[model samples]
Target: MEVLRIILTQSSANYKKEETILNKMTYPLPPFSTVIGAIHGACGYKEYHKMDISIQGKYDAMHKEPYRDYCFLNSIGEGDRGTLVKLNNKNFLSTGFDKVAEAKKQQGSSFREGTTIQVMNQELLTEYRELKDLLDRIKDFEENRVDKVLKLIKKRKKDLADKKKKVKENKEALNVVLIREKQIKELEKNINDRIKAYKVNEYEIPYSNFAILTTSLKYYEVLNNIELIIHIKSDKETLMDIKDNIYNLKSIGRSEDFVDIKDASIVEVVDTIDGPITSEYSAYIDYNLIKNECVFLKLGDKITANGTKYYINKDYVIEDNKRIFNKKKVVYTSEYVAEEGSENLHFDISSEKSYIVNFN
Candidate 1:
């Protein structure tokens, strides 16, 4: 029987037709009884028809009591017809299960996306806070350094002021010393000229004569009168007599009485006699009286003179000395005479002494 069943099952279309007919009749399909029904129904035998009807009637009564109220039937066909029964309770359960699966999938995708956004936001917040802290620290550092730099600048300014004050004081003191030295040099020159003119070997000259001579000559007019004058008088004779007697009458002089008697005369004659002179045989030079010692006129300096050349000296005198040598002289002696040539045309001369020559 099993061999014959295997042979009959080889025809699939015939088996499906019998299965469809049995399904529509409301048969309770047996466990392992599909083969038997398929064979009997496909054979279409009269004896098997009676058995199939009886079994189908019993299946219909069972279905009417329970499955018939909730079940529905539908047919779908592709190449052949097929019947499908749907239970209302099964459809509801299947729809609910599909909805739950879809929701789970959506929730999983959303959870992954949300987690990534949250992590990124946290990292950004952390970076922003760090940057803010760094900025605050840098600002504080710059402020503190600026304060220190300002303090240093102020101190430098104070130090510069102090140095400037010291420099000013030093310059003032130097000017005072220069003025004093100028005055002293003027006085010394006047004393030396008087001694040389009188032919006095002694250093001490009468103070009375010095005062009278200096005042009458008007030397160093810029100096205070009181500072230049000194008083030294004797009952026997004047200071001029003392100076003449000490030098053994080596210098020329007139009576002090004559000067005193002519005191009321015109001031022009007295001034001319007392003024500086550059006469022959005199040690004094006239132009020396006007020039300052610190500032000398060179050869290129502009000048006006009657003679060949004249130079200004670096000292001043109030009176002329009669018995002195003033002019310079030069002498040349040669015995041999030679023809003029380019090699002999030039002459070179060197001297340690400086000659005073004027320029105009």
Candidate 2:
């Protein structure tokens, strides 16, 4: 079988594990889905093109890099407890926010009174205060004027119902009472709608623009000096397109993990081989292949050796507006050898160096 083989290098990279949060963990090699996604992105394909990928890579070292992670609350904090930030743009909680002020004392600091508070942006702080004042005024109007008017309207409707019974003998008087009741109902609806519009447009929308956030120092497990050997098995047209646009491949893991494509070429791979073949680099070997005794682990001096089992993400289907990822069970290790040939294992002999191709 003919396959597209690629060699890529990255100075520093982080293949993020989905479950980790505080200390962002890294995968030893990029998953199938990540590699496929990168290829699709490079090819600028809007739809998922069917393909199988074999990912094998090695990294020189790994280290933790510390960074500040800001957690934004759902709503702006009421009291002066958390950090007050004004979104550079309004109504969205995003990274592009200016630090308006922060409480110096974690518990007792008053941001509004400027007591035990550190003011970062004076203009934004003033705007926040103005918005707060407007919100207060809106609340006062809703409580004192809107509520009072609604109460009066309710009482008038009740009184009209009673008056209608009294004027039942006279048709004109009864009609007048019914007409007034309808007019009062319409007026009440208009007043309620206007108040709602004012609260949302004038106060809530503008006031909520400022966000409350808490920050914590977190670490990201980053791999350095990563080298990846990837094989793509697809249709002839797809393989040719990939080889033609191999240079368009930017990054495999994170956007910041820029990849330098070292080589891209079409190579002949065979599934049947007589002699033993050992993996030159670390790879995500299929768990079933290892479990079924088709692939054996190389136990050097140690009594026993086994690779780490990882249920890595491969492909996904969209369900209920969420990506439901299909996972592949695989063993991640370089110490693996296929003594006897298996259907799933293949050998690449096109180049001077031989490699065991294990596709998941």
Candidate 3:
């Protein structure tokens, strides 16, 4: 089979695990999607394309390094509960109609997560009209949705009564009055928020206590001076396109980890490669596997993206609008056998299991 061999070298890189949240970790080999994403990045394609990809790489644990993680919490009405944290700065959240355009222009321009909270605050104010409108809405709800406010007001009154009971009868009334005032203010604010929500909720309440962006010291196991070999199995036209602009392809793993592309040539797949585990290959979407506890390797998986590690679980079909790739097979080893097979092959190695796939 004719194939386009693309050689890429990276000095330092980390393929983040899919489940990583807090601490960033690194995978030895790039995932199937990551490779395609990088290629698509260079090609500047709008949508995903269908193409067979073969990836094999050798990397060593260079060292553990720290990186800043950015997360975002969506506004109210979108959902309830915990905020959504983005491991990487995909885009900066901005406020105001003017800043919305500015934000779009600056999207992907910087890897850093900017002042999202500030932007959101600006958005909520909306020329201060929203605040006035919300106040008016709260009053309207008091007359309309009287039941909703009654329960809330009654709760506040009950709490106040309890507080008064706790205080000595002879104590100064000023403190009690101050407490009452504070409670009333809080009650009104809550009512305002609840009523505004009824009228098509707008901005998410960015309470400093609930919404938070924390920075902590974390480390990622960086793969230093690694080389990856990607075989592009596509038609002559696609091959020519890649050959022409292969150099334009950027880093495969992390953006900072630049890939040194070399040896772009047409080649043929040889026989089945039988070898011991010298290095690990990425588990792409294909190579089907059944749902069960399958012991593949002694080591766990690395996801430096959010600094987390998790083993593969369940079987899923890898497909988008443009492509339907392989159905991954379960394996007993950490590495995948990257060889051309006439038919899908599976075998057992003593107590271990392996799956080899062939793509025509």
Candidate 4:
């Protein structure tokens, strides 16, 4: 048996676990579909191409940081918003202040008379957008309100020209600004404290503010110069195609996250002294997994990044467009003897469904 092995390195990367919002997460290693997609992207195949592959990698270290981004989906440009309003005008209800005008004309002589009238109402319309977008707009409004209050406070503080004379005049505005500032500051400080706590405890932090958080954002965990190795086993033709394009692979996760491919080549396998069956070979066990050979983990059907399994199989199923584990099989790498222990698995064994595998 001949297998293609590829080694890749990435400085910083995010394999986002899309199921979580308000906070983002990453997988320990690229899943099967992500790997398949990267290969297809490099090979110029627009659709899924059947292949067999296994991935395992080690990162020097990783840390999470809050990232701000003004994403288009969450925001609207002025012109774009206006155009959308005009295009979707009919959906909104009429405001009470609309102006109504009526005109009537009467014509015709002795024998018969005809009367015609027309009524027109001019209205002000507001379009409906996503609830999130509406909240963003409200957030923007509050931010502006706070900014104005802050500026007023600054002006009042410097209104010391007449001392006693200006004191009473600026008193109300100064009081309003000071009160708002205190409220906003208190909220912001508490949020910051929560962020600090998350860092210390390793919990998911949140993004919210009394002031409009103008910046678009995401949460990311970074991996520094990590080594990623993948094992591929397929027919002669499929293997050849993978070999041709695997070298061209530039990324394994998001487009911006790139891979530094150090090696992409096929290796010859040596057989056992007793037989020609080969010392090592890839075997896939899926839907037909023995009753006690496999275990599936679900958080009451709620999907998450950690413990989400990825495996290799002949058929495929995609979950949330990112999870591509299709009843795939698990392989034993350490001893291959498959006794009762001392084997390395692509997935961290979570339960004792397979006694040969260990769990954390």
The candidate maximizing lDDT is 2
lDDT for model 1, on a 0 to 1 scale? 0.23
* Residue-by-residue lDDT tens digits, candidate 2, 141-199: 88988899899999999999999999999999999999999999999999989988988
**TM-score to true structure, per model:** 0.13, 0.85, 0.49, 0.43
**Per-residue CA lDDT of candidate 1, range 314-343, in tens?**
112244754232221111111111111121
Provide the lowest-lDDT 10-residue window in model 3. Answer: 95-104
Q: What pairs collide in candidate 2?
A: none
Sort by lDDT, best first: 2, 3, 4, 1
Maximum-TM-score candidate: 2
Q: In lDDT terms, how accurate is model 2?
A: 0.85
For model 3, residues 215-303, the per-residue Cα lDDT tens digits are: 34677878888877667777787777778888888787678889888678776554444652213444332323212211123234521
Error of 4 at 245 (Å): 2.1
Clashing pairs in 4: 69-216, 69-217
Specify the poorest-scoring 10-residue window by lDDT in model 2.
Answer: 296-305
